[model samples]
Target chain A: MKYKYWRRSRVIPFTLLLSNLVYVSFGLDPAASAPLVADTAFTKSAFYDQNEQCFRCHGNSKYTYFNPVSEKDVSATMCENRVIHRNEFYTANHRSFACVDCHAAEYDTFPHPGQLRMEAPYNCIDCHGYDEQYAQYHFEEIEEEFQQSTHYTANGDAFTCWKCHNPHTYRINIRNSTSMQQSIAYDNQICLNCHSDFERFQLLSDREEINLIQKHEWLPNQGLHFSQVRCIECHARLNDSLMVAHRIMPKDKSVKRCVECHSQNSLLMSSLYKFQAKESRSDAGFLNSIILNDAFVIGANRNIILNRISLIVFFASLGLMLMHLLLRMIFKRND
Target chain B: MTEKVYHYPLWIRLWHVFNALLCLVLIVTGISMQFSEPNRSLVPFDLAVSIHNSAAILLIINYLYFLIVNRLSGNRMHYKITEKGYVKMLITQFRYYTLGIFRGEKTPFPVSEVRKFNPLQQFAYIVILYWFFPLIIITGLGLFFPEMIITRIFGISGLFLTDLFHILSGFVVSMFMIVHIYFCTMGTRLTSLFKGMINGWVEIH
Candidate 1:
């Protein structure tokens, strides 16, 4: 009886070891294979779960596919639409929020319902409008401005906030940015993404593809203007309530006059360089002196002291010349 | 017949006239650009830019011609300040303009083939043509090709400094033009010097 008990113990241990080996070789986790409960309990549990739970599948470049031949979970081709770069998401402005905060709780299911893909995304105003906490941001005014924009007028209900600003990555860079050039580059990218890209542009409008160079041919030094200033500097209507002007005017209404931005009271002072102007209010008594820190726009950046001195010298010279002419005429008459 | 001298050659006269025209155009357009307003402008901004740029280009070419001819020809001798008692000569010429001429005094400096300009005129021309003209040209070019300009100088935008220099040089040249024209009237007759530029001869009375 003791011998029989020893043999049974050995057999049971070997069986357990073999099962474990098979499970490991097949890349199967019992916990992962557990059936998903599509119920209130699961949704409530997922609501409190960390971002890693959602990132496990969506953040991965490759999707797991069960291969019958290999009897294992092998990596298949990347699902581009489903993939979200973990690093990018974490660094973005919305990083603090849980995925479920924006996404519906129904997405907690193992295989998210196909219907969820067609779910209407939240509008910017849905959360921000009339909220006292966000009152300072002026979302209501921005909404009003957006309603009047060409983008809204053209696309009607089809256009969303996501058209220009990607909720996943959008940041308040213009107001807070230290470098104007960097802000210009970042902000212009949003416009160029549609305006410069034919495929993306066609998604919004039925017009033929535009060549930016050909369109802006009248502007001297087109490349310099493009790099130095945001597209909205000339395109968008100025709004005092919003940090950025959302009321994008039609092409015909856009600012074309060079002096509009290249003057003592530059239009850019209220728009592209608004934050910079505010920060450096003490301008050494020079007209548009704040612009001199970042750029040198002709007609805009004049030194008050230099201008006054020049005027004085010019008038004095003119007066002396006039006197000289007067004396010459008098001497001639006397002679 | 009045005593006359051939002080200006065909090429010199041509260059001078073209230079004067370009300078006038540039000055007008430059002022318009400087004081341009969005609604009210002296010259329409677009037209001013085109005219200013074209005039600037022509001025550059005219200046080059002046420099090359001055280098190659004996005309350069007129610009040289080599005379003895030069400062005294300048003072005497100054006195002529300020007080002597009203008293019907003869000019301290006379027009001759060897002396195209008086001591004071020579000094003024040298400063304006050789110094201020080149300064305006270089700074104007810098403004034209803004990308090539230094991004900053002494913690100030280089373009701003360049523009300021261009304006200052332009102001000096403009003042010189006015004074130079007035000085030209002090010749034997009021219109004699004007006729001299056109005919390549000056009445030496």
Candidate 2:
């Protein structure tokens, strides 16, 4: 009986070990096969191990390259293409991902083959499109917007999401930012990176470089407008479903009317101030109450009670004056 | 026979004309901005803003001149209610306008060298110029440089409160302007006060 029990115990553990080995070799682990949605808790040790192997070379500021002629690895200064900031990568939205998840396994080879560099980069839709887990993000809809935008229309396939949004470091600033000013600055920097930089802009268009100040001189308090609000507030075609509007309109198509932002029903309430408006919807006593904390737009920040009272007082004063005039006329006729 | 009193000097007359013109422009533009729709504005929004700003600047200059001249000259006394029974005096003037004027009773307080304005006129001028004028000007300046305005007051937006005060004071001043024009007709003739303002002379019967 003792001999039989020992054999059974040994057999069961061996069998469990063999199954785990098979799962790793075939990428058939139940957790691994599951959908890689946002906020998924990754296997920490394995995820770090996979990424550390790639980062050993990529994360180093003084990365070395193989010198075939010299028969040695020559130290080289880090370039933008190779260097990945360790902190930024770890804190990013895709922090839980393994390096090989997006990149091909061929990149794991040391002194990567030249053909690997030519491999087409993954588009956002390649992994995210048609996936029910990512449907809420509307990646397909963003692709549609990008296709219709001025950037895509003018430059064709040359304009990609990476031009404005660096996937390695991109985060949802509008929703997560501590201040509106910070969010405005962060978003505007993405547009200004290309729009303001003549060298960067020339890559997209050969048109004469724009003088932003002169172009926006028609705006009242141009500096204040630029600092307080994002460029997309007026320039982008608003979509109620999207958190940020991606379909940028041409200059002529952009909003030029002051009433668009300075009315009781301000477009800013839906665009720039969307999150704040959502948070403060309970205080519906005043129009544009969300903006009251940051700004006081004339005609937009109106109190209904004050409006009615002012109108009554104005008409009452006029009525009293008219009554006095009528009484004087009647007395004169009697005399 | 009529006696001519030199109640208004050349500077005062010029100031009155400019003040009237600027105030009228501000009132129209201000109301258009406050009440008019974007598409159906009484005055086009941009043009209204430009005109309103220009008029406001001129009014500020005109107001400063009035203040300096009043301080240097004796005109300030006409605005002071120093009499012991001034409330009674105001009531009497009010009754004269509401009842006695139609009955052809003589004015209890007529225009003279010592008193350029009656008690009622004195009170209205004091409240409008001293109280509402400064309130509107301060609040207007606050709106112009919003950064300088306090961010909050009693847990409410300071800018909103400033705007509310500006609108309220503006409404009162507008009402006063209309009544002031009508009151000018109470002189010997409908055009008498207007002529007096122009020529710097009032005809007392």
Best of the candidates, DockQ: 1
Best by TM-score: 1
Q: Which parts of model 2 have CA positions greater than 4 angstroms off?
A: A1-75, A105-109, A276-285, A332-335, B85-88, B95-105, B151-158
How many angstroms is residue A202 displaced in model 1 relative to the true structure, after the best TM-score fit?
A: 2.1
TM-score of chain B of 2: 0.96
Model 2: residue A76 alpha-carbon error in angstroms: 3.3
DockQ of each: 0.56, 0.43
lDDT of 1 by residue, B66-184 (tens): 98998798788888888898888989999888898778888888887577888888999999988998899999998888889997898777878898898889888887888788778
Clashing residue pairs found in predicted model 1: none
Worst 10 residues of 2 chain B by lDDT: B32-41
Tens digits of lDDT, candidate 1, A1-335? 32332243335533343344233222243531222111111333222257777877778877775667889988765587568776556444454456766676677775679987876676777655665656777989999899999999989879999888776666556655657778789899999999999988999899999999999999987877998889998999998776689999999999999999877899988998887777677558678877777887877877788788878987898898789889878987999
What does the lDDT come to for candidate 2? Answer: 0.78
Residues A132-151 of candidate 2 have per-residue lDDT tens digits of 65566688898899888998
